[model samples]
Target: MESLPEETSSSSSTTTSGGGVGCGGAGEKLPIRPPIQPPSEKYSPLDWSAYFDQESDVFIPESENVFHVYTAGKEGPVVFCLHGGGYSGLSFALAARKIKQEARIVAMDLRGHGKSSTENDLDLSIERLCGDVLAVIKTMHGDSPPAILLVGHSMGGAVAVHVAAKKVLPSLAGLIVVDVVEGTAMASLMHMQKLLSNRMQYFPSIEKAIEWSVKGGTLRNIDSARISIPSTVKYDDSKKCYVHRARLMETEQYWRGWYEGLSEKFLSSPVPKILLLAGTDRLDRALTIGQMQGKFQMVLVRHTGHAIQEDVPDEFAITVLNFISRNRIGPNGVEIPGLRRPMQSQQ
Candidate 1:
């Protein structure tokens, strides 16, 4: 298995027949015809049960909204995951399958996304999003919460930082923010609408949507896309096609709130934290200063897009497991055996 880099730095062959054939000449060699191949495996949607140990809705107390959650593994420190905008809990399906070997995963669908519902789903302001996460944790774990390692991606990363800053979850063990930086995210907000407008609004089937996601580079891993994309869309009886379950364009007003002040908050949180990014170029001013001060671990995962977890799940899992081991974190906040301490920085 490939290990993390020491520092935070960061093809098809065609075969052709050799013999040339003249027009029915006596010495002409016959052209070789390729034998029939088996039919291609359909890019069918995969069920949540295939990756997650259980799928259920946790009803928030004193509220009509119910959040859908996918849980994996029976034991170990809880790795609570929150998905990015326009994605669902299923986006972490592949990563959960691998990480569950060393830790439990609780990935939840945010309000207005996936199967999760709310009175005003579009109210995705930072405060409301944070409240949703806290509510779910309180309702599920009650007074006694397990040691949780919070992991979030993109918009979810912003939410994770805000949630951690609240310091409400006493058992919160650590934080992992993936491929999101406040400066970069805020700067990209202007172009988000154009990006959203350009996406295909409808698909003939879930398989087609998955295919498009892979081919269009929205998601590079086809297997991950097949399982995750299905949850991102819903069948439209009127249009006779599938449309995005969450209308991302409609939530444009909340985009800025998700990312503003994210870096400072992430650094201020009183917990061991790590920042995983697809490239070092995404680092903003605040993060660069924090990283220089050794405030948190910064990992650059090359060749991945924004969805680093789904793009390279094995690597992502190993990164998380290493984080847990390096921190000596175990189930229920105990020390795990046989885990090595992270190496010291030579520089």
Candidate 2:
């Protein structure tokens, strides 16, 4: 895999290339471009690389998959973040910045996503994905096992449930699943299939690609799209164009049985879990608060869509930090002092 560009400080100004009506000089102002909408905030210099550290590579033996991992903070309980389908580890850039101060944040691109290798033709099953996650947890812990908190979104949430069900991580602490529920997953999957079916496979310029990404989906936050699009697309020197890092067809294949029987596995697991939903309207009426009362905590993030972390990152980070800090589980299967589950609400 090609090495990512070196990291730059948050104060640095990064220029956009590919000149056109929408593209301009470093300080030039332009009209809002369709598809790739300009960010809501005042246009300042933007640099996506400043959000996280340089990427580190990891190879998972169980899945025979090589992953691109991005980490922050040097010490604290391990917090592993898994991104949703068609998204990379960089999707957690904003959340990582906030959570790293409290915990060791480790986010990775799952097999066939981001800079990770998809050439192995490995089965993208939930079991294999869970194994990949377990490998990373063990590798991070080294000789002695340490408590780990797993946070996942969308398809990633399903993967986290499988991992929790396996109960392989003796030091596993808790779980936070974002914007995905077993009851609503099939509908979400159908929507994703329709969207990917019509998505552009290749673009002649990076600006066009970015524009397409911003306007294509339910994403309302242009700033988040700007940060996310760059990492998801790469310039192909051979083809003289930019293409998605992961093929749309391959991503769709993985969704075949992604949510089947996940709710049962998630609720039955003994691990402490939190289900963070983006919108209550999209939630399955069948899965009520009563059912999840003791099994898992459910919180609703209002006014946001599927990408809860991106749309409302500060709240997302704070919620996770509060959840982890309050519900900390020690290695001896005992709750740490000052740890208590936060009251759930539909805020």
Candidate 3:
């Protein structure tokens, strides 16, 4: 489901930490000194507070479910973000910094991920996820909800389409799906188990996990990995290391359900939409045809993997700001300068 991890290079320089005895002014014979090994680079875990302005748990009334959320910006349209499988809300941390200036952001850790607590945490059904989003939004904003633009990446993209198709959010103003296509996602499901197996099962520390996520191709940006990967793992007392927070292997039953009919649902949703991809090759028959007819805006961001937002957060944020500005979909409804107009829709 993701591109092969990009190779990273490191260099080591030998340094003498200890001084060896040599020929002094007394003309003593020089002694042989053993070689000194260079120290390994150290990776450190970053705090979420550095990127996001706030973090809170939205407790659903009359239920044990408590969804963890991160937010920034005080005004403008609310961009509700959903992260991919195995990722937490912090996945959007880097992008939030650039997005907050133009609009508000609300990123949530879906059930079974991060600090979220739910009765049946393993239930990743599309329907269950949709309901969770609606419930949380209602609890957070109530009847007078602010204008909302739903943004999702990978598996979260599929969920976003389904949620928008339901047409429940009266204030829903826009949709932006990042690096996910129905055809590609469905086809990739067969190899998903193998991909999951290849990942390191445990790490000695959160820093190591972050390091692996960057070098292993799961994430391309180390800064993004630093802020995001920590939330995706928990300290395992039994193994004495950090392990994945979500049990992805147990939710195999819901994999297909997440992506099936994604294209049709996304195309049918009546709203201004944008599809952002790492490469145009990901476009399927439906999306390709739809793009030809100007059904939705398609943007290609080169040199990125599946985690487009995390891989190139600054660019991702600008694309989003341009989308919002082009459609005039924010609370202030102001157009951003230099952004092109939306493509003409086919009648």
What TM-score goes with each of the models? 0.85, 0.76, 0.85
Stretches off by above 4 angstroms in model 2 are: 1-49, 61-64, 118-122, 188-192, 237-239, 251-253, 289-292, 329-347
lDDT pick, better of 2 and 3: 3
Candidate 2, residues 1-347, lDDT tens digits: the string is 12323334442233356553445656465665234223333222245457665678876565556778888866677678898877888788887788878777788888777887744534677777887787776665653455678889988988987887776666667888898887778766778767676778888866666656656653545567667766777889998998887665665666756788777877776767788986676456445653546667888888776888887888998998898767755333344222333234478
Q: lDDT per residue, candidate 3, 104-214, as tens digits?
A: 999999999999999999999999999999999999998657778999998889889999888777778889999999999999999999988888999988888888887
Candidate 2 at residue 336, lDDT? 28
Whole-model lDDT per candidate: 0.85, 0.71, 0.86
Among these predictions, the greatest lDDT belongs to 3
Q: Put the candidates in lDDT order, highest first.
A: 3, 1, 2
Q: List the residue pairs that clash in candidate 2.
A: 36-211
How many clashes would you count in candidate 2? 1
Where is the poorest 10-residue window by lDDT in model 1? Answer: 5-14
- Candidate 3 lDDT (Cα, whole model)? 0.86
